[model samples]
Target: MPFGKVPVLEIDGKVLNQSTAITRYLSKKAGLAGSDDWESLLIDIAVDNIHDLRQEIASYFYDPNEVTREAKYAPLINETIPFYMDKFEKTVEENNGYFVNGKLSWADLFFVAILSYLNSSVKIDLLEGRPKLRALKEQVLAVPQIKAWVAKRPTDIP
Candidate 1:
């Protein structure tokens, strides 16, 4: 806290670190949050379960550490990303169109973010063989704000 970066959430002049923790806190404040209960646990599970894999997949595609032919993308394409994506799809369906509940929440936003990542960085035919999941994503995408975001979303990320 003595010599840290900007965007500090000081409580009585105490700085807070950890971006994920801070985002989680803010998600709660906005009601786009989750609970500590069992069912609510899935929300965190779903988000975390996919983040690392998605990041790795993105790095594979866009990171200069990666080459032009998508060599780093093999594992993700052949196994990892699809595996977790399928799990999330099932989780969404099993929970009845939401990640861990019956309403749109942070989990939906998480899914949308991940889908955007997939569309930009990789070729994920999300609905190709998973019609239900595709339809679910489409349904979420149809919402006005999110839809506008998607329409104006940037495809070029370096």
Candidate 2:
């Protein structure tokens, strides 16, 4: 609870925090993680990048000043989002619609998680000019289990 975060997990009497770590652990448990060290490393890289992107978005959300928020929004719309999203789209395309090595790693799941938050919280269609990312989003959300989870979740953004 250092940052008062809610992703704190209790596994086998051991406590763990941080979303990325928790996700990684669960992904491995569910057989959704990478198949080898190299692939796992790639997944880590992708997850870290997503974390930074989410932080940038969070900074804008937490800013109380309209002028500052607007200033940040412009770059996010025209630069930051495109830069990250474009790279993500390319990676997904190269990996056959997945984030890592043509397989379903935690990277793909993290992409969807952050993508959904960005869509709802920022209310921006970040996927507008990115066809691959759009397709990836559709693919991720179409998973039977993910679809069921989304359907039962609250409608509110936050």
What C-alpha lDDT do the candidate models reach, one value each? Answer: 0.69, 0.83
lDDT of 1 by residue, 1-158 (tens): 54476545766677787656666676788776765566457667777876776676767776675365466667777787678767877877787887777666676776665675576677666445666567677778888987898778786731
Measure candidate 2: CA RMSD.
2.0
Q: Which candidate's lDDT is highest? A: 2
- How well is each residue in 62-110 modelled by candidate 2, as lDDT tens digits? 8999899878988887788889888988888898988888877778878
User: TM-score of model 2 relative to the true fold?
Assistant: 0.88
Candidate 2 regions exceeding 4 Å error are 1-4
Measured on C-alpha atoms, candidate 2 has an lDDT of 0.83
Residues forming the 10-long window of minimal summed lDDT in candidate 2: 113-122
Global lDDT of model 1:
0.69
